[model samples]
Target: MGGGVLGTMHAWQAVLRGHEVIHLEREPEARGASVRNFGLVWVSGRADGEELETALRARELWAGLGERVPGLGFRANGSLTVLRTEAELAVAEVFAAGPDAAARGTRLVDPAEARTVNPALRGAFLGALWCERDAAVEPRVAQPALRAHLAATGRYTWLPGREVREVDARGVRDDHGDHHHADVVLLCTGAALSGLVREIAGPVPVRRVRLQMMQTEPLDEPLTTSVADGDSLRYYPAYRGVELDALNANQPQPAVAAEHAMQLLMVQRADGGLTVGDTHGYDEPFPFDVVEEPYQHLRQVAEAILGRPLPPVRRRWAGVYAQCRDTGQVVHRQRVADNAWLVTGPGGRGMTCSPAIAERTVEEIGL
Candidate 1:
């Protein structure tokens, strides 16, 4: 049982199927990766095939949900992975000419065209890889908004502050010593993979990923579209190819950037502040804190792109998300019992693919 985006989306799907759902969460409110993200329905760099398909479907779902729940703040703003160097441009050119370009709504735009798409990018740039399929929603508010929509149907009950301690074929028992009966139990837990998850399915194949993220005060102007620096070409899978390999060989990140696995993904919030991030930390025993080096690097890159200094930093934080070790599996879904299942390890795709992931889980389980 969980109450994050994946779990909330599961509840939404079940209620849509005429099932009375009782969603449970350990915390009174979600204080995890779900809220601590860029709120990006990012489709620009998803690995092709299943991952990309799931993201496209989820983007559609989020758009539809936005119509029903205004608080979702869903927007088809798309994204511009700004490319400054010739190497980054080369990778984007290859991707723009790829077979999946049309499917991903991808295009390579010149500097003039890119500026038209997002005028806030006043800084110099070679070009940009634009993906019109990309979208965004307010991560901090999405779950509560979705839950409110589910509640409107009178088929959903949100039970936060109740951690499931036991699971069986019939139902689950909460930490408060209360048992709730159900026909089937879908454990959509996020990164808390120990305790009940371990008891039910043992150790999972997924690994916990930690990342550092931050938000700015407020930009005087609108960002218009989500933005990414050239470093993204190295991190996202869609750009993987010989061209990328050459680029990587010829242009490696600086020491601090390379050390932290850093990338610049900036999205403007509804309030005008920009949400920027992120550095990947895969090793276990992740630091329980944020470091200044990555943030400094991010600031330098972001300012270089915008040709202006960013507003004062208002918030800085670290979040941990579960990602499948076997990069091939979109998500790890395990049958823990006769009528119980465990689902998690969506990785960064959690926000972008949650709606579609939950939909697939329902179909597979015949829910």
Candidate 2:
């Protein structure tokens, strides 16, 4: 029922299968985690097996969609996880040598090679772990562009600014007093977990995560690939090896970074501006204000990696998304009614795996 990436992708899958679709959005435009993210179709750091498979399939689907929808701005530029310390480099070595590392396109590059790949990164890092499967898209335009493409099919109808007030086995009723009926209904609500969702899902086994990020003015040069710091080793499941444990145990994160659960993921946009960020917050009663400490730490780490001062900050914001507490499950999907389903809690994997997730749903439900 929601119109974020997940919802839009579900609509795309259904309409492509010759099914009529009606998409609903609470906001005039999607301004949630979908738009607030790095537009990264990251496939490198996913957990092995099913999660990695989903990410890989989604990466291919994203490339295909980008070709059909020019506005998608998809790029197979890949990603580089910069390593500064010897410990971090050790972790990268282990990751590159793992059994599935070849499948993930994992490679280790020296500082010179890393710079050759992305000259914008002139920082003095030991080396970087390269993953060729990672990619990027223009999240700011993705949903609307997809919606526009779907609308051209004549079988898709978009209803924005319609907050679903009630949902039943037959259909859903919006706040505008309009009733829409469909054979199946999928609620792709992002982090809006209250009212109808709370009543139906009944204490979703998912937790909400809050994060802060910032964007800067266009840079003088391009960042050829998405970049991440060693801190990412702790956050991504793929790097949970003994080397990473040693690195984490030996080299604790800086106080400011640790305090905010910060990680440095930098990506250059189509316009040359850098999208950098992210500090994690999982507790309820999230702070109402964005603290400056995390931003300052991010700036320092970024400049050290780039070997240049970052451009002046142009925007700053915070976002929240539901993540499944059961790490084994990709997302929390429940049949709230005979024909109504609540699909959510993909966590940070939402953008990376939405297309594949929706495709699986269609297959399972025979939609």
Candidate 3:
């Protein structure tokens, strides 16, 4: 029952198609994976298969939405895939050599140029896979705007704090004993998909991956582009195979940071505060508690890369996502039955990929 990115994305596309869309959620507003995320609109840090096209198309949709829905954190600041190892560099190379990679604005960069773009990266990374077309948003600020836009759409009826208890062949029955109907029903439950949708019942291979992230106090300096390193690739399926294979293979032992699959993705806010993170955990039933180890690891990475410990952590927390079995990215038409569908398992690429997934869902329904 996430009314955050995917729900809003669905509402955006549905309204545009002149379809009446009722978005239901257990929370009054979105504060799940949509808000508890880096908000990096990553196009390149996506799977290299079918999602490539969806990401590309959704990118266009994001840009278009910016015209009417301003301040949705849709900045085109691009992304920098920091390469700290040979394997990471190799993955970047493959992405660059692959078809459509260049078009997506993925390019290999030298250390000098990389430093020129992000001075904080000095001496830490060898180079980076630069995605000049990527973008980011402040989740806190962006969610409000997205919510407002969806609300403004007359075709949209938001049912926040309303839990859907069951779904028969007809529609949904909520906890309040209120029944709502729709011609089609799509589950966007993130990690709770299996529990929410009975069709795919019983321990859907979706496991909850908890990640601890932190935001720094006001910084004198901030990285302009979003940045992630080898640990990021190993954890995020998007950048896993592209350029880091060789580097991951050579490491005699998994790097300590690798254990957490930690990566430093820094995004600067308008006020100069930087949001950085994150450490991955295969915590079952979703981890609401934030651990100190990840926070310590985050500091260590920042110190190693920037040659200094970052400012105080203004905010610290953990987020969870339902990871898919195969590609790790969510797919449309997950069920053969026309009305039933699955939209979870986005890994950490929800912000970048949700727009496309919602658009494709609209397309699939002939909206």
In terms of lDDT, the poorest run of 10 residues in model 3 is 328-337
Worst 10 residues of 2 by lDDT: 326-335
Error of 1 at 154 (Å): 0.8
Instruction: In candidate 1, list every pair of residues with a backbone clash.
Output: none
Q: Of the pair 2 and 3, which is ahead by TM-score? A: 2
Per-residue lDDT of candidate 3, residues 273-301 (tens digit): 77888877774655557668767766776
Q: Residue 365: error of model 3 in Å?
A: 2.4
Task: Answer with 1 or 3, whichever has the higher TM-score.
Answer: 1
CA lDDT for candidate 1: 0.93
Listed in order, each prediction's TM-score against the native is: 0.99, 0.99, 0.87
Runs in model 3 lying further than 4 Å from the true structure: 85-99, 168-170, 199-205, 236-245, 252-255, 283-288, 332-340
Q: lDDT winner among the candidates? A: 1
Per-prediction backbone clash count: 0, 0, 9
Error of model 2, residue 62, in angstroms: 0.2
Candidate 1 positional error at 304, Å: 0.3
Candidate 2 deviant stretches above 4 angstroms: none
